[model samples]
Target: MRGSGQIVNRRRMIAGAGAAVLGTLLPGGAGAGRATDNALLPKLTDGRHWRIGYAETMPYGNYAGTLASIVKGLDALSWLNGAARMPYDAGQTDSQALWRWLSAHDLGPRIRFVADGWYGGLDQAPAEPILQRLESGGDIDLMIVMGTIAGRKLAVDRHSVPTLVFSTTNAVAAGIVAAAEQSGRDHVWAHVDPQRYYRQLRIFHETFGFRRLGIAYENSPAGRAIASIADIEAMAGQLGYELVARHVQAPAGPDDQERYYADLAAAWSDLAQRVDAMYITFGRWSLDRFPALVRVFQERGIPTFSQLGPEEVAQGALMSVARGDFDGIGQFGASVIARLANGERLADMRQIYFDTPTIAWNLAVASRMGYRPAMSALLAADNIYTSLRAVP
Candidate 1:
């Protein structure tokens, strides 16, 4: 693994383009490194602040949390990493870092944070309320939809403003857009990773030779669509393995939370004994239960894998294929929004997907599970954790 100093240098390099773009957007053209002429830059009409709305399927869940991190990362780039030096001690989640940056910086006067909403675990946020808040008065110029469910509904409802969908496992399968290359909607563009799961599964099989893989599936339309099990099944069959899956029920209300964890724990107990390894799917209910689920699998000596990111692997998963640069997503999304705000047609914009995937490994969990990844796998890991603690 690279030294701390090397990693920091790499991060700055990866953030260079983003920081430059953000510099052009800051007040008074402060950090405008290349383009000093204000006329050449994009700006809101009449100096009106650009209002961006944030919507997620499960705002408090892991996927949403990661999306929030991407936003903070953008804020850091906007300020040339000045927000990172702020004295405030942000929480572990990206949402906290975003809150801190918003409080400490003058980003609001030029770029404002608008309506924030989340569809409950059951995909209950209908189109009317979303459209009413965003499209009714033209209060919001752009909306960032976090997951497939929220993006699907917003697209189906025909939101009038430009929309950027992020972190969706599969936009094509969910019918958010006709094809990744061509987003059938003029007002929407999305970032989709259709092969994330396939890549992770292939890596796990080649690394550990896990034949019977166990997974927890959420019972929801979005869950059914994104990361379809049929895809996993076909991949597993070709790879000479079997997929053992259990349907996990989504919590209908607050009272069902405890029961939901209990049911997941029970399922994990049975699955651990049968499967050689475990794969976690993108489900709000399943993700919420990760801490408990990771503990259960760890205790049973089962190596767990996921496509979520490095954070999950650090928490307890044996390994993961994570999005290489978290900040890059925010940077790219910001550029798209900047163009749209500058009168560029949304139909002319193409959807973006992260092609750089990094391997992350948790040596502590691998040791506990009595599994040794091949030397090649270890050498390929971009991020490695020796302890089962959150990545700071």
Candidate 2:
């Protein structure tokens, strides 16, 4: 436990240094050691503020939180005046509302937040025409893609805009990138952590030693990627635990959110009856609805591990790897964008940045399961919620 904590701490220090030095330490960081261009420190080579665009598959808590972190990070890097704040709530499920907020935020003079650059929200039908305009008009200088669906759509070779992808489960598995080391397309860069989910599963298994672990997710390729199904299966094989899974429809259309949650609830209820533990996968379901789903597990005294992050753990899950304040990745992204503004090819820089995972444990949920954490485990948790937080 001490060794793991020391490693995580060392990685965090490296990440912090990398962010400050524009990821100079990262693999394939070609922009580093270039002649200093203080004149274009925050501006593009053409002496203009970079025009930034945004897109996502759908509204999700993580997307909103990640965006907020990026915006805050940019401010911290002096790209903004430190007055700009993300107007959209993390609990918001309306993508249009998010677009409106981004369009309206006072993002300072260093960044031109293209008001009309928003595309591919809940309804992807209109995204094609908008993407076509972006491809031909060349108005959007860079696009911040939030999910796997949007990453696949906008990070392709056909789209000329430099894309920075975030909030995806597995960028490589989702076909958003060639691999963690490089994005196949020059205009694409995605935050990749190939072993993130595997690490999460390993920690969960080490902590609980559950005989049968259950999971719920959509069964499609995207679904499998989102749930890290292959990783889970491998972990199950290695840990000698039975893997029980239930298929719940991932939202395909704008109106499918409610139905998806309904199916997810049913799946959780069923899994609660059969398995000793539950691994909640990333889904479009609102965080507000998680308490009821987690209640199913609590009723059965089943331990629940969230695949997302600490936010979900705060909501109800027993434990997860916490991304506290999102500072590491946020600064990593801000540095990448800064490099791009100063004339760096997106594909030439490394896309692999893993969070320094720390435990996020909910003592209330753990108590419900009658699980007592050892002194080391309790000391290791960075974010501990005594009770479930109120979701808005």
Candidate 3:
């Protein structure tokens, strides 16, 4: 057996070794549902200079955090390739912002950010002049689309703007890939949903011992987009936890906020009767309803989880998983885009999701509902991000 000191030394060596390889591809690059080679996630600062973008900014770390991670990721991405990155703010809508932020860096070995969808949601439909701008690829190298961006909608023309996308649950259904883990044409992808959601659900099952979990989505294209995921059903079955799904149409009129909350309240009220836990996946696009949704789950004892945008979680929710790390996303994302700029095929790349380090749980909310998360369980958790109660 190894001594503790030897074990500690070995772990340190491992950390150093991981840092050493941040830019070059590990033995096995990221694959959908494939095991990761702890030894092989490329290193930073390979010396390649490029520009990448992040469509969404909240939980991904505010403007500052997002940039920090991108720089770190760029260091890793450029490590072997001798790459340096020219990054852009996806949150900004003006082209002048794009040009001003990117001009200085585009001078040498340029990898420009042509377009990025916030959470992969497009700013407009698949029509030219929009499609025209997308198709007219210039010094541009890769085009990345998250979630619905690559669905059947964007295949309007046969083009070679090598593409990559990330965090998609229904990639195949959306026609982005031919199968869950393989590419459709020359395309490739890195996704976060193959395991994250299932892991989150399993933790919920262990904590509350809930046999059935209810998930609600808006009755819209994007909502139905998530509902079509085969993995969710497969994972739920394996956990022996059932799914109760509801589809409430998107609200209409000026007081949409009020209507949205009212509908969600009723959904949970109905779910409480059958589900052991509740799951929601709504935000700016779906409903933009917050504080009230938080109240609904609390009023009832149903433990909840979802892709509740980082802001909502930061305010105080037990957990939320999502598309961008805000800060780190641009780095990795830009790297993938960089590959395209350098001659990597867009069709051969895909987006990937990074796990959040924070877990926001309020012990007060737990008490108001008459429940306590197991201490041993919480301690054993992958990470503990918030304090809702004090130990007496």
* Best model per lDDT: 2
Q: Could you tell me every candidate's TM-score relative to the true structure?
A: 0.75, 0.79, 0.64
Better of 2 and 3 by lDDT: 2
Order the candidate numbers by lDDT, best to worst.
2, 1, 3
Candidate numbers sorted by TM-score from highest down = 2, 1, 3
Q: Which stretches of candidate 2 lie over 4 Å from their true place?
A: 1-45, 72-80, 83-110, 123-126, 254-258, 388-392
Runs of candidate 3 with Cα error greater than 4 angstroms are 1-72, 75-109, 113-128, 146-159, 187-193, 219-222, 227-229, 251-261, 282-288, 308-310, 321-335, 346-360, 380-392
Per-model C-alpha lDDT, please?
A: 0.61, 0.72, 0.46
Question: RMSD of each candidate?
Answer: 8.1, 7.1, 9.4
Candidate maximizing TM-score: 2
User: What does candidate 2's lDDT look like per residue over 1-392, in tens digits?
Assistant: 12111222223434444333322212232222222335225754454777888887766666776776676667776777643555655334455555666667666677877888776563244467757866785678888988877776777766677889998888998888888888887788998877788778877888888999998888999779767788888888888999899998777676777787788888889999999988888877766788776888986899999988776776788888765445567766777788787777878877777654567678888788888877556555666677754434
How many residue pairs in model 3 have overlapping backbones?
A: 51
